[model samples]
Target: MARIQLNNIQKRWGAIWGVRDVNLDIADEEFVVFLGPSGCGKTTTMRMIAGLEEPSEGEIVMDSEVMNEIDARDRDVAMVFQGYALYPNMTIYENIRFPLRMRGVPKEQHDTLIKRAAGLVELTDYLDRKPSALSGGQRQRAALARAIVRQPHVFLMDEPLSNLDAKLRQHMRVQIKHIQRELKITTVYVTHDQIEAMTLADRIVIMDKGAIQQIGTPDEIYNDPANTFVANFIGAPPMNLIAGVMEQGTFTAPGVRVDGLPAKHDGKVTLGVRPEDCTVTADGGHLSGSVYGVEPTGDMTYLTIKVGDKLIEVKAHRDYRADLNSDASVGFDPKRIYIFDTASGQRLR
Candidate 1:
């Protein structure tokens, strides 16, 4: 519903920075996610956009209009919070209708708007119940209904699903994505969970140390991480990084060695490969290690191999089994390996 822009946005407290030199363009009706660890400034950036926090520098713009001087309520942006920010004393219907009433919508239109919002979020049955009467998922749905009733130009959600159980989170993720597509509103979601970012975002903005690390589709960022931080951060098992030395067209590390590699950069480097890319063998392969641990997760098994000072995670098939402390070897798929500069943590071709 609106195109959002953040230009060189920075926020600081005296000497410490919260968000630094952030520049991003959110397309009209696009679903964008701000992803990072706690204290990484993703929440701060979203807060700046919602007018909850004032930026120490730069501008926040919506639909070609600068929003720095605008009040949060006047900006026509609805925020759904992680804690569900609902009035505990009010019924679900009243909570959903709160926004409409605050914005001075006619009393007659409130019922229709509230009903539509509740129905969209599957909260119509619970509308007569107070928030305390509902489960966490139901409470979250009511919160979403509250924001939806406003029909704001921009939808800002800060980890709205974090409070739910794993199963409930999955269910709500689908609902949130469906609702956004149906409404076609420009939504900016913030979360520390990469799975949420990868699944829900049209494009993901990854931040670390109060700076944007990389911005791309889930596939791009996963397949081609800009740095080691992103490589390790994106995956559930995360990419395995082994310290090595690169010279000429070959790379060498403890228990691992590869040759005929692309000749781009040389010297000490770190090799990155996703857990799925590694195949575990009993004896010998590209690398050798000892089985540190084995975890069976129903559908698949996770093999933790200890190679000298490094631990490599291997996502093996479900039936795969290995004894702890047993000898193991790992074959790295040459085509899938990533090389990063050891000092800078930046990718090297």
Candidate 2:
């Protein structure tokens, strides 16, 4: 296992910068995930670490050794792509054994290592089947087995589960987490899927437009986002942001009001509240609006309220009322509120 550090790393495509001044310190045996939307420089950052693409500037240090000039083959890092990247004609056992063979392991040892990896990935039964004969999930498991058989110091995965169906993705998530924990190899997985990052990562690095936005544990990023972008990006249904001014210890909006906001913020501010934070009240609430829509998710119901030009989503245990066009007052606790600077989108406190 190894620790990875990227110092002032940069990647440029002619005049356009792909990834700029990116610095991250990943500890040994830590499972760190790089998460962001597409074209957000996540893949560029990973490629630089793998030496698949050299940085325009900066250094990559692994296990305390600077690897700026190291070739990918010499870096002792293995990468699993979105596609399984297995040889179609090669049987699963052969595919798993290929890396060991290339590394010049003895033929006798290949069986033991390959069998162990296949067993770990639950592919012992399908070891003789070719990639074309396997299901998508099975093929992915084979790919994972191949990566692990080599026992590289650092494992870099670029959306390795993107090709699977929803159900398979969910199952593979648990499997991947189990394997990562069992092996204790340093891993950096890049994905745009927030659920994947939240479930699998020890810590998450959120990026956008080639810049680092925030890096923290899943709870830290979800509960206390560093800025407006992180706040909006990390949550499902996102956070509701209301533009208003803080005056007289309250936040005044077009057709809504949040009480006791001035204690934490002043001047122009954006008030943030998650769907789960807002409540429907019959009376004595902070704001009132008509229900725009209702979404049911079996365990919880999400209600979107239309207040002038703004729409706020509230999460409730169940569908509160039978009618859809009802008006309701919604209230938010002051402690659950988030205040941000309108101009800079930075957190207030």
Candidate 3:
């Protein structure tokens, strides 16, 4: 419904910067997610776009119109909060129709609007039910339906799925993705959940401490992180960060030696290896450590190794689950290794 452009967007809370120098272009009908850890300014950035919070600097334009002077209600955006925010006394029908009614849409149009929204979210079954009678997933759907009925130019969601249990959250995510795709409305979602960001977003904006760290597709973020923070933040079990000194093209850590692969640093540098990228070797690997434990996650197994004082974790397929408690040799793929400046935490090619 709208293409969003933010240029040098800044939000300052007194001396503290909530977000700074953020420039992003979100295509019309694209699903974009602002993702990072808590206090990373994701929500603040979303609020600025929604006009709920004013930016200290920069420009926000929606569908070619500058929005600096526009109020939140006039911005034609609908926001879904994490709390659901459903009216306890209102039935599902009333809740869904509340937005349209507030705008005094014709009485004849309310039923058609409500039905279409309920159908999109598959909440027609519970239209007569109160918020008290609905399940967590159902309640979330009701809230989503309410947002849809308004037909806003852009949709803003701030961790809307965080409160649900694991199973329901997964189901709801699929449903939300489907609904968003079908409607083709511009959407901005904010969450710290990497899985949610990967699955739902067409492009993900990774933020940290009020600055935009990286913005890319899921594969781009996962396979090629911009810096150490992004490498550590986006993974499920997370990437292993080991401190090592590069000497004569060999990397040596306190307890492990990574041979063959060379580095350009005589000074200490941090090496990052994704769990899945670490391979188990029979004869000799780059590093050897005592097996701390094994975590079986249905299809894949995670092996935690104790190398001197440091713990390294690696992911192996189900076949390696039997190697638990045994001594292990690990090797990182050369192409998969990420090197970061020890002092700056910036990526070093």
Candidate 4:
């Protein structure tokens, strides 16, 4: 069992802070993902946990033991990087066996361990092939097999699926999640892709500018964001944000007015609504705008509307049709609307 805890963990380089005051408790066999844009410190925090980078402050404890001073090799953690990192000169079997060999495992155990690892990744048939002979997905599986061969206490994967094509990435996401479940290893994955984090993680840690924005299950993060940064960053087209003023529970802005909100503040505010939660109507809608663009993606249609200077995206049925530059009415449920403080970008309860 591997229960990991990061206590006020921080990483610094001279005056620059890479990660700051991160505290997390990862249960045994739980899959946690660190998600954010580039330079948000997700990778930095992962490196600190892996012992690749020393933390400037705080402690990393595994199963009640402090690991800050422990060497990476002795930490019993396996890492799969964005790059496949396979040995071009070596066959897949040899590559998978390298970790076991380095740890001086018995020669008699190598064959069984290697076969099991390769089979787990469905690469048993490709064991005899060299890395140069394999496709990107196959190569990544080989890397995964190598990590699996070690049977470490924890798995640290840093954007393992980023190098693959879209379909392959989707396929590998399932495979990785399945493998992690089968192995029941405590896994901490780092990625910038919100889709990956949403689909695979038991819980997600959203970070930005060396600080954690929020930590919660996928449903919570998507349905209830902590701030404007999270609301804007997690979605595909992102949440539509309109600058406005709230007075006596009524929010008013250019071409928009939403009522019945909690009258917490009456000054400048930002209104957030997701594309899927919005609907297009004929008349008497909450907001009115001119259709700027329409994109049909087989399953759904995304309609972009210009409300004054701001553009709002609404998701509609694939069969829905709209004319560009035509006036459109957009409406949403007041209960679903998110209000934020414009000055702080923080959620307004």
Q: How accurate is candidate 4 locally (lDDT)?
A: 0.94
Q: Which ten residues in a row have the lowest lDDT in candidate 2?
A: 319-328
Provide the lDDT at 55 for model 4.
95
Report lDDT (Cα) of residue 58, candidate 3.
96
Off by over 4 Å in 3: 260-266, 321-326
When 1 and 3 are scored with lDDT, the better candidate is 1
Candidate 3 weakest lDDT stretch, 10 residues: 258-267
Cα TM-score of candidate 1? 0.98
Would you estimate the TM-scores of all the predictions?
A: 0.98, 0.97, 0.95, 0.98
Candidate 1 segments exceeding 4 Å error: none
lDDT of 4 by residue, 1-349 (tens): 5999999999989999999999999999999999999999999999888999899999999999999999998888999989988888899999999989889999999999999999999999999999999999999999999998979999999999999999999999999999999999999999999999999999999999999999999999999999999999989889998999999999999999888888888999999999998999997888999999999999999999999988999998899888899999989977789999999999999
Off by over 4 Å in 2: 262-264
Q: What is the Cα-based TM-score of model 2?
A: 0.97
Tell me which residue pairs clash in candidate 1: none
Best by lDDT: 4
lDDT of 4 at 253: 98
Residue lDDT tens for model 2, 1-349: 8989999999998999999899999999999999999999999999999999999999999988999999998888888889889998899999998888888888989999999999998999999998999999999999999999978999999999999999999999999999999999999999999999999999999999999999999999999988898989888889999888987668888867877655747789988988888888886677787888888888889888888888888887685652566777888977888988899999988
Q: Which order, best to worst by lDDT?
A: 4, 1, 2, 3
- State each model's CA lDDT, in order: 0.93, 0.90, 0.89, 0.94
